[model samples]
Structures are given as structure tokens and as C-alpha cells.
Target chain A: MRNEFHADLQTVSQLLVELAQEVRAAMRQATRALLTADRRAAEAVIAGDRDIDHRYRDVEERVCELLARQAPVASDLRAMITALHVAADLERMGDLADHVAKTALRRHPSPAVPAELRPVFTDMAGVADRMAEKIATVLASPDAELAAELDRDDDAMDELHKGLFGVVLGADWPYGVETAIDATLLGRFYERFADHAVNAGEHVVYLITGHPTPS
Target chain B: MRNEFHADLQTVSQLLVELAQEVRAAMRQATRALLTADRRAAEAVIAGDRDIDHRYRDVEERVCELLARQAPVASDLRAMITALHVAADLERMGDLADHVAKTALRRHPSPAVPAELRPVFTDMAGVADRMAEKIATVLASPDAELAAELDRDDDAMDELHKGLFGVVLGADWPYGVETAIDATLLGRFYERFADHAVNAGEHVVYLITGHPTPS
Candidate 1:
């Protein structure tokens, strides 16, 4: 029975890694849709979110069940709790990706990002993608060191996010208010994507060290 | 032993209500600061968020401890799970309020919501404040009916949020890109506050019925 519980726990951990991978893809696709105004890609990201959510719910149910039936103590208990928190962060990351996709769809036919601002978004998306990749890797390995690296990546994302505002709010900005609003919100989406990645990293760090890195 | 476990469970539940109340006050004070351009109010709201976070962590530790020590099953287990989820939502709500306060401070001495668009923000804050209040009441009483009503309030918030965009994007709008950006982000802060409240309400509904609500 104890062996079976460990196997189930391992399955739960595997699902978390898979969930992270899905969120990474969803956000990347959403960024593609945003940059190129590809309706199909946007639709795909929006649609794929349901699958991510399904997997997230699967994690939740398994974790709750393990806590109840296994009555896991100490590190095992922390693992169950961390699985739930990590799954939730992954699920929310998927939603943020969906939000980005929906924004792309809202401005269909014309790119939501202007030509000049596209590179900034491309950079932001690049950082976000790398962060998501690292998130999956850390969740799979529970490496405290890699998780710490994601924080530096988050700082880079924040720098890009701030630069985005500088460009949009620049005195000579050529875009109208509508584009400004879109830029503002889009920047928020990517910034928050990175923030959630950092949050997931924090959870993984806690799982490994049993000492939560201060928020 | 069973009775003692429940007493601890009750303490956790009571903390959830207090959390909801703190969130309500935080958002309300944040709204006041935005409307009045009161730097002190904004600072207070920002500083108060730490207290909210501290309480949130307290709830988290107590729930995790109860789960480890008591190994509650059935409704007791559901209650523990719900408490964690609800506390998280409340904490996020508090953060949203902090965002609103910071927005106000960034525009200090000059109101974040222009005089013309102030009414919409007023209405949004009113809806969010009421939702927070209702969240506290529902958590305290575990009333599915009241919890369900928070969804209606969320819809109201969405409408206000939409109307805000319409006004900002209107051709007659006189504000510059910066104000529009501020309005867009502010609208989002309130909208997400309401979203988190609905999330907490769903958690409560699940706790009461033992049947998960469709997300």
C-alpha cells in the first residue's frame, strides 16, 4: 500500500510537469497570434486552455485524495500541498495566455502589436517562454538552483515590461489611445505571466528546501 | 480529539471571514484614495496589505497543521481544502486593492480617475466592496444562496468595466494616452478583485454542497 501511494504521488508530480509544458505552449501560441494576427493560432491557444484546465483539475483531485486517504505527513504532506499550489499557478498561467489570445482575436485581421512595439513583445514572449520552460524543468527535478534562476528571468521580463511602457508612454508615441490601451494590457499579461512563473518557482523551492523563499 | 480538531477548524473558518473583511476594507479604502487623491489613504492601503498577507499565511499554516495532525476526512477535509483556496483568493484581492492604491499614488495630488470617469469607478468599487462584504458573510454562514449572489455582482462589475473602456475609447474622450492607460489598468484591478471574490464564493458553495461548482 505504501509503495502504491508513492507511485500515485509520482504520477501527480509528472502531471504537474506536463501541465507546465502545456501552459508554455499556450502562451507561446498566444504570442504568435498577437504578433501576426493569426486568428487560427489565437483560436487554438484559446481552445487548448480547456485541456490545460482539465489536467489542472486532475492534479487537484489527486492531491486532495492523497491528503485524505494517505494522510501524508511531513515532506509527503508538503508535496501534496505544493502539487495543489503549483497546479493552480499553472492553471492561472493558462488563463493569462487565454487572455492574451482573446486580446489578439479582438483585434483580428490587424496585428494587436504595432510594428515598432513588436520587438518588445517578441522579447517579452521570449523571456516568458524561457521562464515556462524552466518552470517545467524545475518542477520535474525540484532543483532549487534552477528555480532561483527563474527569478532573474523575471527581472529581465520586468525590465522589458517597463521598457514597453516607456515606448508607449513616450512623448513622441504615434499610436492612438486604443493601441495604447492594448499595449498597456498586453504588457500586463506578459508581466503577470512571468510573475506567475516566479510564483511556481517559489512553490518548487519550498518543496525542495521546506523553507519557503520569502515573497 | 475530534472536538478539538473541529475547534481548530472553526478557528480557520473564522480567519477566512476576517480575511474577507480585510480585503473589503482594503478595496474600499483604495477606491477612496483613487477618488480623493489622498496620499495618506493610499499609503495606508498599501501598508495594510502586509497585515492581510500575514493573516493569510497564518490561515495557511493553521490549515496545513490541522491536515497533518488531524488527517480530517469527508467534510472536514473539504473544509480544510476550501479554507486554503479561499484564503488565497482573499489575499489576491488584497493585492489588487494595493495595485489600485499604488495607481492612485502614482498620480498623487491628481485623481487617478478623471472627474468625468469617476462615476464608473465609483460604481465598480461599490460592486467590488459589496462583493467582498458578501464573501465574508457567506464564508461565515456557508450560505450557498449568498455565495451565488456574488456572481451577479461580478457580472455587474464586468458591465462597469466594459462601460469604462467605452468611455475611454470614445472619440469624444479628451484624456491623453497616459490617463487612458491608467483607466484601463485600474478597471482591470477592480474587475479582477471581483473575479477573485467569485472564486472564493464558488469555494464556499462547494464546501456547503460537497459538489464542486462548474468553473
Candidate 2:
């Protein structure tokens, strides 16, 4: 009976790691859809979000079942509960990606971003991608040191986000209302994606230390 | 031991209700501050969020301890787990309110929103306040039918949001870039608040039905 309980716990952990990778792909896919102005890809992200949401529900149900049947204790209970929180965050992150995809679809036919801001956005995307990867690693290992590094990367994303906003808002080209809306929504998507990544990192710290990071 | 366990479970339920009420106040106070541009009120909301966040963590920890110590079954486990998710959504809703308050600080003395849109915003504030109240009520009594009604109100917030964007974007006034930014951010806060309300309603449904809402 004990061996079966341990096996169930292992399955839950494996699901947590898989969820992280799924979220990372969704984030990348959503960004790619935006950069390329590909309506198909954007639509794909929206549809794929349903699958992510479903996976989150599935994982939660399984965790609850494990708790009920296996009666996990202490660290095992904390791990299951952490799994629940991280899965929800990951699902919301996917939803944010879907928001970006919808925004991209709304502004399709390739409305170009200002050249000056492109580098900032590109950097933001890279940071977002790396944050997702690091979150996956943290879930797999619960490494407190690695989780602490997420804050530095989040700061970089914040800096790039500000630059992106400054360039778009200060532009002289008058790209019209559509351009303004797209820029605003896109910036928010990136900022929130980074925020959720930071949240995932916090969960890792909590899982290891049994407390959330200080505000 | 069983009697003590039941008493702790009752205490957990009471704390869950108290947390819901506190979050609702924080949300309403922040939104009112935004509309009135009350800096002190906004600052209060900002300071008060830590309290909500801290209390949320406290409830979560207590719930975890209960689960570990008592090993609740079936409906008891469901209620506890649902509280965890609902508290999270409530906490995030508080954050969205704080975001709105900060924007209010930035846009202080915001040129009076045009005459045509003043009532629209008031209507929005009404819907938002009511939604927060309903979320609290649902948490206090998961059996209430009011939660389903609140879920429908989410669609009303979306409709009002569309009207807000149309009026602002369609206006000829330069309104400048700042108005555009304000409109976008305000729209986002309202939408997200509604989304959290819907999440709370879904939890209520899950509590009664033993499953999450239908896809």
C-alpha cells in the first residue's frame, strides 16, 4: 500500500513538470503568432488553451484523489497543494498568451511595429521564454537558489517593457488607434506573463521553505 | 479527536468567509478610490492589500494543516480545496484593484471624463461592486443560487466595457496618448475583476455539484 501511495505521488510530480513545459510552449506559440502576424497560429493558441485548461482541471482532480485515497502527509501534502497553485498559474499564463493571440488576430494583415521598439520586444520575448523554462526547472527540482534568480530576470523584463511603452507612446508616426491598442495590449500581455513567471518562482520558494516570499 | 476535528473544520469555514469579506472591501475601496481619484484612499488600498495577501496565506496554511492532521474525506476535502482556489482568485482580484488605484494616482486630476461617459463609468462601478458582494456571499454560502446569477453579470460587465472603448476610441478629441492608456488599463481591470467573480461562482457550483463547471 505504501509503495502504491509513493507511485501516485510520483505521478503527480511528473504532471507538474509536464504542465510547465506545456505552458512554456503556449507562451512561445502565442508570441510567435504575434510576431509573425499569423492568424492561423493565433487561432491555434486559442484552441490549445482549452487543452491547457483541461489539463489543469485534470491535475487538480488527481491531486484531490491522491489526498483522499493515499492520505499524504506533511511534505507530500505541501507538494500536492503547491502543484494545485502552480497549475492554476500556468493555466492563467496560457490564458494571457491567448489574449495576445486574440490581439494579434485583431490587428492582422501585418501592421508593423516601429523599428526602434523591435529590439526591446524581442528581448522581452526572450526573457519571457527563459522565465518559463526556469519555472519548469524549479518545479522539477525545487531549487531555492535557481528560483531566486527569477527576480533578476523579472527586473529585466520590466525594464524592456518600459522601453517598449516609451517608444510606442512617443512615436511620431501616428500609427492610428489600432496601433495604439495593439501596443497597449501587447505590452500588458508580456508584463503579465513575466509576473506569472515570477509567481511560479515564488511557489518554488514556498515549496522549499514553507512560506511565500516577502512582499 | 473527531469532535475537535469538526470544530476546526467549522473554524476554517468561518475564516474562509471572513477572508472573502475583507477582500471584497479591499476591492470596493480601491475601485472607489480610482473613480474619485482619492490618493489617500488609493494608498490605503495599496497598504491594505498586504493584509489580504497575508490573511490568504494564513488561511491556506491552516487549511493545509487541517488536511494533514485530520485527513478529511469527500465533501470536507472538496470544501477545503475549493477554499484554496477561491482565496487565490480573491487575492488576484485585490491585486487588480490595486493596479487600478495606482493608475488613478498616475492620472490624478484626470480631465473630467466627457459628460457622455461619466454615467457609463458609474454603471461599471455598480456592476463591479455588486459582483464583489456576490462573490463574498457565494463563499459564505456555497448552496446559494445567486452565484449563477452573478456569472451572468460577468457578461454585462463585458458589454459595458465594449461601450466604454467604442465611446473613447471613436471620440475625435486628441485625448492624447494618456487617455488611450487609461482606457486600456481601466478596461483590463474591469474585465479581470469580472473574470475573478466568475471563477468564484464556478467554485460555488463545484462545491454543490462535486465537479467544476461544464466546459
Candidate 3:
């Protein structure tokens, strides 16, 4: 019995999944630019963020309209609300990706991280991208188990983030103040990206379990 | 002809104002901690963030209940949703203040920013506190004009933020990589705090005008 409400909710879920995929690609691309100093890849990520924002707004409008017209019951209401918050998280993930790209651009013709630290940035991005992937997966079908995995990925990101500080603060660090600042900020951007992914995963867990996790 | 819905919504608005004030005080206290290296002040800000998060969650529950029970009309719904988001912004502002406090604590027995940069942080905190005040005022009575002023305040914040980098990057800068990283992150925390305030103000403007400005 696919009524208008069901059809529209389905569409919204699909849109969320697609948006998550877009954000994931953006993160991966930004990391590529960061590791290789690829101006073109960086430019593409920066340009792509607007479309992500546009789609985010589209999701917002749809969710609001759906809530208003359908007057969804309790379960449906929770799903709608969770979708709204997840959309916001996805949009922010896009912004983090954009920040990563800009960091790369700022050091154009120069890798954003030192050669020794490139592996760390790569691993950080890997964890973040994996979290985004799981977020997208859980959105398509609420999987509390799958959603729960993002926390583990986030721990990996934190470890990498801490190791980055170690390198920047190490005595042998010759890059100087500017590079250290860049690395510090870049590390933060990825860490935040991973965090948003984790939050979005929690949103999915709430959707499935009907219990908001402790903040 | 005030119904239960109006009464509940009124309570929500008042709660938001109080939360805004609390967040404002936290930021000011954090700055004091940053400048004076006052361990007690820093510890207070850190401990106080839990209360802020609890209040934020309370607002979220109230808003959801109001929407579900009342099924508010479009205009009222917009206000309810906007309040939900503004509460989130306020809560995050508290988190930023906590970040500032932790930075102060990290360099305990020593200030976070250098002596020369103390004034910059002082001025930045002042503008941020003023912005929080306006947010509280606008929440009490939706004032588009007051909300509009946040953008200008945000511009002032940007100038200060840029000036901070200039000082940090100056050739005569005595602080080495550690202090530079600390200053960079602390500056980012304040800048983000300001940006969230501006966004919250825009949310108020949207509530008043019923037109969401471009993203």
C-alpha cells in the first residue's frame, strides 16, 4: 500500500543515501588532493560543495512538507526528524571536505602534509570515508549494528589525529610554524568530519531503536 | 485566548533566552581563564558544559512534543524548528567555550595566547559576548533588525581572526610551533563560535521574516 506518504518518505531516504555517497566521494577526493597537492581535484571538491548544499536544502524542504501534510504518527515522526538532522550532518561533512580541499589549495604545488605524515592523513581520510560509507548504508536501511561501527572508525581517526600532533610537535620538525598550523587545522577538519559521521550514525541507531543516545 | 500550546511555546522561548545567557557567561569566563590562566575559572567552564548540554536536550524534547501534540501551523512550526536549531547553536557555543577553557587548562600556569596576543583574544571575546546578548534579546522578542546586526559582528570577528594570524605569523613572533598551534586552534574555536552565533541570528531572522536567506 504505497500511499503518497510512503512514496515520498522512500524518496527522501534514497536522497539521503545519495547525498551520503556524494559526501563520501568528496572526502576521498579532498584527501587525494591533500596527499598529492592536486589542484584540479581540490577545485572539483570545492565546486561540488554547492550542489551538496543545494541537495541538503531540498531534503529540508521535503521533510518539512512531509511532516506538515502527512502529520506522521510517532514512529514516522521520529524517522522524519532523524532524516532532517542527518541531512544537516551530511551537509556539514561536505563543508569539512571543502575545508580539506581549501587546505590543499592554500599549499598548491606543495603537499599539505610532510612526506612522513602523508600516511597519517591518508589513514585518517580512510577512516572518515569509511564512516561516511556506513552512514550512507544505514540511512538506506536502518542498521543499528552497521551504524555502531562508525564509532570504531572514529577511534582510528582520533589515533591518527593524535599521531599527527606528535609529528608536528616533534623536535625534528623542520617545516616551521606555517606548516604546523596547516597540519593542525587539517587534522581538525578530518576529525570533525569523522565526528559528524559518527553522529549521523547515532541518528540512524535512534531511528531503528527509538531511543536517543546520551549526548 | 492563550492555549496550552501558546503557554508551552512561551516557556520554550524563555528557556532559550536563559540558555543563551548561560552560554554567553561561559564564553566570557573562558576568556578570563585564557587571559589570566585562572585554573578555577577554566575548571568552572569545563564543568558547566554538562548543564548546558542537559538544557539543550530538554529543549529538544519540548520542541518535539510541542510539534507532535500541537501540529503547529506553518508559521508556528517554523518558530518551533528554529528554536530547536538555535538551541543547538547555543549548546555548541558552550562546547566552544569549553574548548577555550581546556586550552587554558592545557597550558596551565601559562596563558594560552602570548602576552601580546592577549588583547586580540579579549576583543574577540567581547564581540562574541555581545553577539550572544543580541541572540538572547532577539529570542525574547523576534527582532529582525537585531538579528541582522550579527552579520556585521561576524565581519568584525573575521577581521580580528585575520589579525590574529598576522600576529602569529609575524617574523618577530617569539612563540614557537607549540604556541602557534595553540593560538591557531583557539582562534578557530572563537571564530566558529561567532559563526554559529551569526547562523543562530539568521535563524531568528527567518522566523521573523518567514523567508530563509540564501545558504
Better of 1 and 2 by DockQ: 1
Correct interface contacts retained, every candidate: 0.70, 0.59, 0.46
The DockQ ranking, best first, is 1, 2, 3
Model 3 spans with C-alpha error above 4 angstroms: A1-3
Over the stretch A78-126, how does candidate 2's per-residue lDDT look in tens digits?
Answer: 8788888888888888888888888778768773344565677678889
Q: After superposition, how far is residue B32 of candidate 3 from its true place, in Å?
A: 1.1
Better of 2 and 3 by DockQ: 2
Best by lDDT: 1
User: Please, what are the lDDT tens digits per residue for candidate 3 over residues B1-215?
Assistant: 23887899999999999999999999999999999999999999999999999899899889888878887768777778788889989999999999999999999998778888988989899999999999999999888998999999999999999999999888998989999999999999999999999989999899889887555
Backbone collisions counted per model: 0, 0, 0
Q: Which ten residues in a row have the lowest lDDT in candidate 2 chain B?
A: B109-118
- Show model 1 residue runs off by greater than 4 Å: none
What is the per-candidate TM-score for chain B?
0.98, 0.91, 0.97
Residue-level lDDT tens digits of model 2 in B1-215: 77877788777667767777876787677767776777787788889888888888888988999899889879888878987888887888888878877877776666334455667777777788888888777666666578887767888999998988887678574676657777777777878888888887888788888766764
DockQ of each: 0.82, 0.69, 0.68
Give the docking tier of candidate 3: medium
What's the best-to-worst order under lDDT?
1, 3, 2
Q: Superposing all C-alpha atoms, what RMSD in Å does each candidate have to the true structure? A: 1.0, 2.1, 1.6
